[model samples]
Target: MIEIDALTKVYGQAQAPAVDEVSLRVPAGSVFGFLGPNGAGKTTTIKMLAGLLTPTSGEVRLGGFDVARQRPAAMAQFGAVLEGSRNVYWSLSAWQNLMYFGRLKGLRKARVAERARDLLTGLGLWDRRDDKVGGFSRGMQQKVAIAAALIADPPIVLLDEPTLGLDVEATRTVKNWITEQSRELGTTVLLTTHQLDVAQELCDRVAVMRRGRLVADLPTRELLAGFRERDRYEIRVEGTVPPGFEAVTREGVTTISVRVSDPGEVYEVVARLRAHGAVLESLTQVQPDLEDVFLALVNEPSHAA
Candidate 1:
């Protein structure tokens, strides 16, 4: 539902582009995670997709409409909740905010009212629908903003740090809501966040950026599986670690992690630990998660160079 083609963005007089030839396609009804550290241009790419910023080169299309050439039609295909900004009117009640945004999208009052009720109720904000958003907690306010964004039932949603500062409960609620919208309503989600665990759980596919370039893009499970194939193990012991072993001590337990290219190396490590008079507590294969894979990808020797 979203297509970006060789998208490049260079700020005034800057030698390097903020986003360089970045291209991606997000399938309809799928959750695609856009990940990068600070200044990696994820936000810049998002701004271009939202038509908030003009790209120095290339193009963005939403639901097949070119964002730059068909601004209104492209905009009608998506809704965005950008980070570090208030997405809703603080003085407006939650219901009012939804109605206003829905109407702005050309939705009829009766249709918007029905959607508002359903969205507010689903977001657990129905009770406070009539209350001013300024008086609500940050989580509540965020929920209201999200409701407003979806009030028009746009097919695509651009969410930057949707669960950033929420408490655990609120985070879970938002996460579940995203999943439901994608699974049930066939909504396409383009999510950008620092929360790797959340991305691991929700994103069908993930793309990582570094220095304004696309570094890695793959299905979430495939990415994790590639990292998992590495033979790494974590060994915990009750005594001193031998020389040449990197160990961390915590609560009287010495932990050592090592990667082996050969199965024989496992026994060699165990024998070395035994020779050091260390009482073995446990030995387990290390399973890499999204964070582990992400760090490895972003911190590659080439990236560092």
Candidate 2:
């Protein structure tokens, strides 16, 4: 539902572009994660996609409509929750705020009320439907902001750090809602999150960005495979060690450390140990995780260069 071609955004007075020649495509029913560190042009890219900021160069198409040339048509097909959750008026109750935006989106009074009630109930905000948003906590305000975005039932949802300040329980609620919307309603979601674990759990595919450039784009499985490390096999042996193995003396006992490429290697190492008549005490493998990959990519001097 979304296509970006060579999207570049350069802020005036800045030495370089905030978003540099980035191109991406988000399909109709996929959860696409946009990842980057702070000031890495993630928010700038989202703003350009939302038509809130015109790109210095390139094109952004939303559901067959160019965001810059045909803003009304492009925007009509999408809903968004930007950087902050301050869209609703403080004086109005949650229901009223949704009702107001619903009408503005061209929904009938009855439909607006119905959607407002359903979303509020779905988000567990129905109990405080009559409460002023200003009196609510940050989490509550975020829920209201989400409800406002969903009132129109747009096909594409753009969430920029949806769970930024929410607690664990609240974050889970929002995550569940996002999953349901994409799975049940077939809505296309463009999610931007700093939490790699969240993205790994929720996104079908993730694209890592650094320094305004696309560094890695892969399925979660494939991405995980890239960071998967060889297993470590530790064997404790008695007496003099075999010729090929190096042993370290700890408490007057010799312990050997070997790097096993896979399970088959572990089996071979154990068999060799038996042949040499060395006492084997323990063996274990440590596998790399997503955090390792994230750190490697972000820290690589080549990526920054």
Candidate 3:
């Protein structure tokens, strides 16, 4: 539902582009993760998509409409809650905020009321709907912000750092909302979050950016599987210390780290452990998470250079 083609953003003549020639396509009803380290241009790209910032070159299309030229029609396809919950009013009640935003989106009053009621209640804020946002907790405020974004029932949602300062529980709430939006509601989500676990579990596909350039984009599972260093393993032994083994604390468990390039090397370690009369506890293969992939891409000498 969202298409970007060689989009570029430049602030000054001599300065590097905040967003280079980045191109991407987000399928309808899918959750696409937009990930990068700080200053990687995720925000800049989203702004261009949201019609908040004009791109220096190329184009953005939303719901098949050119966002630059058909801006009103393109913006009608999506609703957004950017960083700091800036889209919502601090003084307005949750109900009022959602209704106002719905009106801004050109939703009919009756439809806005119905959607506002459903969304606020769904987010467990029905009781607080009449309370001023200034009196609500950070989590509560965030929920209201999300409700506002969805009040128009737009087919697409653009969320940037939605769970930024919330506690674990609140973050989980927002993550589940993202999951449900794609899985059950069929809403296309373009998400940018610092939370890797959220991206790993919730996103269908993720695109990693570095220094305004696209580094990697693939299915979440496929992307994570690519980061596995198959030679690395950790084994826990209870009885005796093998001659060449030294225990390292990993997640409160003492594990002997070993690197085996082949099956024979693994067998050699087992043979040595048995020879030492060691009692095997557990054996686990090491796999990298989204954060690992992100760090590897952003910190690469090639990307930096």
Candidate 1, position 36, lDDT: 92
Steric clash pairs (candidate 2): none
41-70, model 3: which lDDT tens digit per residue?
Answer: 898899999998999998999999999899
Q: Find the number of clashing residue pairs for candidate 2.
A: 0
For residues 129-200, could you state the per-residue lDDT of candidate 1 as single tens digits? 999999999999999989988988999999999999999999999999999999999999999999999999
The Cα local distance difference test for each model comes to 0.92, 0.85, 0.87
Which of 1 and 2 is the better model by TM-score?
A: 1
Cα-based TM-score, every candidate = 0.92, 0.84, 0.95
lDDT of 2 by residue, 52-127 (tens): 8989999999998999889888888888888764867889999999999999888999999999999999999999
C-alpha RMSD for every candidate: 2.3, 4.6, 2.1
- The lDDT, on a scale of 0 to 1, for candidate 2 is 0.85
Ranking of candidates on lDDT, top first: 1, 3, 2
Please give the range of 10 consecutive residues that has the lowest summed lDDT in model 2. Answer: 283-292
Displacement of the residue 243 alpha carbon in candidate 1, Å: 4.5
- Flag regions of model 1 displaced more than 4 Å: 229-231, 238-244, 249-252, 272-280, 301-305
